[model samples]
Target chain A: MRHISHTDINYADLFADFRDPNSGAVVMFSGEVRDNNKGKAVTHLEYEAYEPMAEKMIDEILNAALEKWPLNKAICVHRVGPIDVCGCAVVVITSSAHRAAAYEANRYIIDRVKYEAPIWKHEFFTDGTSEWGQNCDCSSPSHPHHHEHKHHHAE
Target chain B: METTIQVTCFAGLRKFFNCPLTINLKLPTAYEDVLLEMKKVNPEASEILDSCRIAVCESFVPRTALMTSDEPLFIIPPSSGG
Candidate 1:
């Protein structure tokens, strides 16, 4: 299961669908919005995505993980739009026959989704300034030095 | 026939472009052309996009990748999602 949701993520609803009697292990991961970033106090976070592309890319990430692991179920949910600090932003859940596969696959899905998905973040800082978070780990050859946010001032 | 790529902007770019956006290209276009065009519309976003990545058809493409006008182009600024 994969979705780009605008409403708050319902963890229980997702976990319910993740049940698989054949699987012995289930792993779940949730990422929340924090109140600070790089030493700057944040007011809130606004998330946006190329909705159609974001959903499609998320499926690709899940398919890649399914190929590497013997999994019974895989579910990923990403929330878009304004989220208050400490609100859940994303979740990854995987169920497999063994703990090792479940854990590993869960980690892989989340990491790949973070870098591959067409999702973008706009951080509102307490200083009344906002900036787009750079795609530092997008894993694209075109972004070899994306690790740093390069800014050019208008003359 | 002319091709108009659906260019979706997110986050800061969304605010800048008032997204649900599209760009027209003359048949053959490359990734950099999109960037150049975006810079012309909003110079401030050029710097922000410099730190961003561009994805076509849900995959990140290199600057040199050639795209036709029908393909969907997404200008992805650095992602903060987990």
Candidate 2:
């Protein structure tokens, strides 16, 4: 049960934090800001989150993944504020007794993190314009329907 | 029976609502119900909720996700960070 971090991530420390001798497989998934979005060259990206609620939601997603799979330990870390291009956006580490559970849960957590949490990103393009994938006029409900997403770290 | 629920909203989600972080709402309220009330409070926010997901004590509740459970209901806004 952990959810705290800054833009600077030490996977070495993070992996060491949750790994155990009994755990055979340690799988992690990281979501990052890519240089391109929607066929546009991205210059940078901005992320905004509802901290408390977002944390609560993240915990829920963690629990859902745990219930859906088997694992020795699970950890999720997300970043907030303006992120430079290629920065780590989200991190999910799943340590399980087997490789399959660790791998499966790792993927599940990232997908759920995007769909379940309320964090918005503003993608800045090479043309000096940006678009928010989850932006609204500040009106209407946000259903987690989008499927295509980018991962920061994998395997 | 009605009681008061103290909810602390944050980040992008805060911008979505018209109420302050610490506001009084009826207790025994589900997360979705509060979201509906949130629509009235912030019509701008309601649109976002339509596609959003919620959590009660760290469990993802679908659009059909209800808040009838007891204690600790958090409405998550979209976020991405490491």
Best by DockQ: 1
- Misplaced by over 4 Å in model 2 are A1-4, A135-155, B1-82
**Docking band of candidate 2:** acceptable
lDDT of 1 by residue, A103-135 (tens): 999988887677667777778999999887755
Model 1 stretches with alpha carbons more than 4 Å out: A135-155, B1-6, B15-25, B56-61, B70-72
RMSD of 1: 5.0
lDDT values for all models: 0.77, 0.65
Q: Fraction of native Cα contacts kept in each candidate?
A: 0.60, 0.34
* Model 1, CA-based lDDT: 0.77
What TM-score is obtained for chain B in each of the predicted models?
A: 0.85, 0.62
lDDT for residue A99 in candidate 2, whole number 0-100 = 95
TM-score of each: 0.78, 0.62
Question: Model 2 scores what on Cα lDDT?
Answer: 0.65
- Give the true-structure RMSD of model 2: 7.8
